[model samples]
Target chain A: MSPRLYVDFVRRLGNMTLQVRLAIDTEILVLFGPSGAGKTQTLQAIAGLATPDSGLISLDDTIFFQRVPGKPVINLPARRRRIGYVFQQYALFPHMNALENVAFPLAGRRDARERAMELLERMHLAYLAHRMPHELSGGQQQRVAIARALATEPRVLLFDESFSALDRPIRERLHEEIRALQAEHRLIVVYVTHNLDDAFAVGHRLAVIRDGRIEQIGRIDDVFIRPANQRVLDILGIPNAIRARVVEVGPSGALLDWDGVALEAPLLNAPPGAQVMAYIRPEDIRLIYPDRPLSRIVGTNHLDATVVERRMGRHVHRLRVALPDGRQIEAVYPASSYATMSLAPGERVRLALRKESIVVIAVHSDPPPIEEEPRLDRAKCADGCPKSDPAPVSPSPS
Target chain B: MNWPAFWLSLQVTAVASVIILVIGLACALLLVRVHFPLKILVETAIMLPLVLPPSVIGYYLLLAFGRGSPLFEWFNLRILFTWQAAVAASVVVGLPLMVQSSRAALANVDPVLENAARTLGASEVRIFWRITLPLARRGILAGMILGSARALGEFGATLMITGNIPGRTQTLPVAIYDAVQAQRYADAHLMVLVMTALAFAGLLLARQLEPPTPGRRADQSAKASV
Candidate 1:
């Protein structure tokens, strides 16, 4: 089936300060950005709540809005455009009960009561029909809003931070419900959100907007692994960045020289002897046994490193390791990895990195970190038992 | 001063208040919801009676309704120095109060709810009746109560426009004036007590219907309703 919505437009927000230029062809296009990036404005424009100065908005061959010079004719009113909008606050009528809110659109229409009941049933809110908006829980109110929006059987759906008010567990379930509904309906959803994690969770195609301009947009994996620029990298919270030089030009790919140690990096079209900042995800850097059979000195210098600081992350342990020049780099090891490794603070270990995962940001750089001594390493197991702490500087040569 | 004059005053006030509630509500809807040129001017013109002396309004009504008058010729009905003319005067005085308060309340309903309703395939008229009107109902009710109170207290314009023709045009206020002229203050006191009770009740009801917020109130109420 053809795409329901094809929006190729640039809209200037009120007073022409912020501009939103978007081009997308997805079942669900997630508009992700910080506040004032025009995310909600974009949703409003799509749902026909806000008018754009000039743009062609087409949904399945219907022209909703278009501004042509004197003969402008491509404008359709919001009611004529079959788009359902679920507001952030639910926007349910406080005076009406849950069923009435869901059935609000059906009023004066034939079989309105039956249709409203059916919609409530679909949203699993049939039993709470007579409950007012305040009486229902936050999650139930949201469902009523969803049902009301879908009651009209609109071709397009728009959301303005619909799950922002709910707690985590409820938010997760709502996301799942929305996902399930999208699967059933060939819906063109224009969703707005400020949370990157939420975007990553629900977004099949992610659009990162900064200061009203979409910095980058692509599939989730591509955007996460190969961000368009430094700003995109920062949005994903990947913090381990080091400035490097091309130490050696191998037949396979370019070797990134960090300080005096060479690291393998996936290169594309870059000539030998180039300077770049390498972005390494903490998860990919595997601390391994230096002499293990599976281990190879893939880079010029596989450095011996001592564990310094260890902190708890979401379901994992974050460890900071010290290199030779008093610089620390953070890496994550699962709780299972720490349990099996029997590693303690200040212990020496080898770090392994796959070539494909290391993203090279083509930019100017200072130098790779070189930590002389381990500073904040936790001298214990995952159980928090004390082990021998390492001295300031461990002079281990492989 | 007589029973018929007293009854005429009560009847005219009741009919005038009802007419004001309907027409004033329509005016309020136009002012608050629909956009047009001279909106502010029209709004000011409608609210002009609130500040104008009752005798001034009475003079205009007299010119409009008296025998061989242009307004009398246009309406083709007997109104001058009659109960209907008294009703016209009361409506003229009471209208501004109703329209002003109703407009304020309707302006406060949420535009989002009406838009949402429209998106659900409701016609413009349907949106007004179903979404906007119900949401702004409290405000409209308040305006009606206020109009009723104003109509009850209406005196100078009503007295001048519809002259004191006993049992025909003479209303409670006029009857009170005649009772005082005849030195029947005790009889006037009963009418005064009734009028006072009605005015107080209307004001109390208006206060009850007044919106919680100064400008905006409920969500659907802020939308267009005309």
Candidate 2:
């Protein structure tokens, strides 16, 4: 099928306004972002639930909204559009049975009951046809929602934090179910999620949104590997960032004086005398002993550091290394490597970064803002004084 | 028994209750769903009839339909002092009750249900009819019954709009007033008995829709919330 699903619009939430220019017809485009990112806002705009201030939204050849020099009218109510929106809450009608809720749109029509029963059967909710939404489990409700949306066979499907409500195992199984459903229906799915694992699992393409803009939109692996800026590198959970300067530039790649390690980074277009910060994913960095050949052969951007902290996660050990310059960088090694290295906190080690793995960004950065002011506390005289108990006071006359 | 006045009162209350129910529900839907520039002002306006005294409400209706008024020509359309005038009075008194109860009912509905209904391809009108109207049926019933009871209790507004014209304007309330003035104690007592029975029935209906108090049953709340 031709690429007909396209969304070009601008919408606002709070003080932040999101402007999205996108075109996707047959792919599962997962909007990846932190909470309060414009991921869900963009989907709401496409669904016509949230109106854009000015812009055009076109799905296929039909124009849903437009703002131009001569023409100014640009609004469409949600019903006029044929988007199947699955709310974060399944939102099943409480009064109706599972079958009746599934067949609700078909109500007031001939054969509505039979059609509803058919839909419920597909969702494996036929047995629960007489049951209300509260009677069903979280996973069952999700299936019912999916079945209801597909009842009309809509062109595009929008899921806003849909699986975030379910239990973990159920969430995983639902992903497979959704994928199978998407393949069978060939429907264009625009899923908005804050979970990285879910985005990578189901998304054909990932759009990372930050501060009301599309920071980067590309294939999932590409965005994860090469984030465009420091903000994205930090947002995507990259652990190690080191300050460096450009020493050599080339057409093939540039040599970075990354903390005096002469790192052969495959990024360029920077003048030789520029100060940069290289971002590296922790998984790429290897913790090697001083005697290793790889540690000895390092020329560009290598750090002789001592491990200051070790954290054991589900699948890997997170080691925090403090370089000689008093800057810390983190690296993740397989759990198996833990036995060989005999690594522990405060042990000295050598760290290495792959030439292509280091993403060098320009120097200026803004620190996160503090929302609340700091208050000074006086000495406390009682037990449970400072930790558990707050400041005790006599009642002021009301 | 004064069957004519009894039947006339029932008819006026039923017809007026129907009109108030429809208009009040429409206003409630507007207040709940649509966002207008003067939303607060419109809400205050819809509820204005509630707080206004029956005498003040009658005075305003009389002015609009009274002779020597601009709209008096339309009064020549046979509304003033007719049985239709009693229905009009009922409409005035019944409006606030209808609007308030319907708004409460509509407000209780989960927005998710409406959104889900829309995405499932049901039109806006269909969602209201099938999903909203049905779910709020008990509230709607209570609102109408309250309006009916209010119309039954109407005295000042009815007297001002439609003077006591027996078999036409002499509803049970109006008839009772006329009986007491003429020193017909037995007649007034009989009308009182009938009015009390009807009032009790309305109270029964209103009680049926008592809106289930908070935290009693989750199922009841879900049903009420649509």
Candidate 3:
């Protein structure tokens, strides 16, 4: 059986109390949050660098840290934990060359040097084994640090924003490499990154942490498409969170009454007259082309809107549109489409919102945002939304 | 030129410098890495000799190691008016320089690197030996050189505690004072020149161990030419 890392702890840090609980298996679980969200602290706790006030942390059958009021405290020292951690700064020993650094933890082993060289080769850093940390580039140094961390054959590998400092291409390549490494070793990995792209590129599951607490944890697509609470929605930075009420529900779907505008959304378990927040991404709002056939845009909630404002982004143009009710909604169009359509302020256009694109989150209950059932109304959504693909309404870049 | 005094000063300073390095580093490590109550009080006590007059320090050491003090009464260490007393005075005067410099050097070593070593499965002893010591070597060396220089030039404290016993307790500085008192201008001038030259050499060595600055990189690279 594959190993599992279970962490449940509460630690008071000055004014902030970090109470975290997680169970990670062989797959990578990305801890996603803003800065100071206790993601690094969680990693520290797991690595045995930080002791918790009172809780139990275990990996498989081994107890890593345990502190109960009446029981004998069992806090393992960091050196004994056998967990690998790659810090943001790499923290390579400035004086030691790459080979020596990797060989440091292998002191008692007879084949320490050979094993370290092999680890370097595994990281594709064999040629730079003699180089000091300052002589290597950031990514090269990072790889050396990884090689050093792997020398001990740790049970779990924790990376704290390890790729945020690299260029986009290098970062993406490393993301792929880490995924391959995790699979090859079958090691449980926990990655902490505040960057959304980093989280998506490397994570098999995502845990959204906020204010020292996990707001939601689920498969990446589920959390993005159907956030459990207002906090999770806000952290995802979804641009449109419109106040609405559930007006009607059927096997087909639920009808949401936004400020004087009715929007068709995925089937919700919520009752009618319940206050809800309908979250829609700007890219999800599609502009209906008059020249295209109506069949292509069928089953979408169609609305007449006048462009109140337009702003140019690097690749997309953001159009702030006003419904006949005077309520404004933001939609994004590709620069190519905006240019071809010659869209401008004060121009009247039709917008289409796929029912699957709208996520209706209840304002109250504020329950944990995991284990949400499939909210997709398959019968009505099968044609417009692909079950596996998230953000189905947004056109693929290719 | 008071050759015996010159030799005695070298012996006292060498012995004192070695003791200072060991104790100073231990104190420095404690100050930088440990957390305990009254830490500020300990730090102030260590630094007191740096600012206090050598005579006042001598007075305190006298009482502590004097006739009725615990060190003398219990251990019966009759070090007064001996070369050992001169060594003690040199150590007392030189220790503050060593501790302050070593503390700064140890503090400058990034704690993050130590934590990284800890996570990498290195014990505290290994981390100190492999990581902390090497990284802080330059500053610590500089501190040792400075402390040695201070010990070599020690006159006031040695005079108060050991008295000016020619060919025994009289260090170079004290010997120079004795020569000038007897109106031996030539002997005083020669001893003074020797002391100044030794101090200058020590200071230059200490300066060489200083961390390189941006403006000095070109100079260092030229010197290294590696």
Top model number, lDDT:
3
Tens digits of lDDT, candidate 2, B1-226 = 6789999988998899889988988888888888989899877876787788878888988887888777777546557889888898888788888888877778767656776686677788888887788777777778888888988888888888888898878888988988999999999999999999999999898978857521122333122210
Clashing pairs in 2: A261-A300, A261-A301, A261-A302, A262-A300, A262-A301, A263-A300, A263-A301
**Candidate 1 interface CA RMSD, Å:** 6.4
| DockQ for each model | 0.20, 0.24, 0.25
List the candidate 1 regions with Cα displacement exceeding 4 Å.
Answer: A10-12, A17-26, A69-72, A107-110, A210-212, A230-398, B36-38, B66-70, B73-78, B212-226
lDDT tens digits by residue: candidate 1, A1-398? 54557555566655444455555543567787766776766766776777777767777677888775675657677777878988776777766787877777776778888899988898898999888887889899999999999988877888778887788668767876776787678676777787654564466567777666778887654575568998887665665666677766566766887777777765433445656645666665666654455444333335577888778767567888887777777776565564556456788766766564465543222232244210111111111111112211211111
True contacts kept of 3: 0.58
lDDT of 1 by residue, B1-34 (tens): 2678667767877898789988998898888768
Per-residue CA lDDT of model 2 for A1-398, tens digit only, reads: 55477777777667788878888766688888887777767876787766788788887877777775598686667777878888677777767767777777666678878887887787777888888877899889878888778777778888888888788668767777776677677778888887776775577678888878888887664565567887887676656656667777787777777655677776565567665555665666665555555533233446688888999877567898888878777877665563657567788887766564575533212221244221111111111111111112212101
For all predicted structures, in order, the TM-scores are 0.72, 0.70, 0.78
Best by TM-score: 3
Worst 10 residues of 3 chain A by lDDT: A373-382
What lDDT tens digits, residue by residue, belong to model 3 across residues B53-143?
A: 9889889878977999999999999898899998898888888899988788887777668888999899999999998888888878888
DockQ of 1: 0.20
Fnat (0 to 1) per candidate = 0.42, 0.48, 0.58
Instruction: Give the range where candidate 3 chain B is weakest over 10 consecutive residues by summed lDDT.
Output: B217-226
Q: What is the TM-score of chain A alone in each candidate?
A: 0.62, 0.64, 0.67
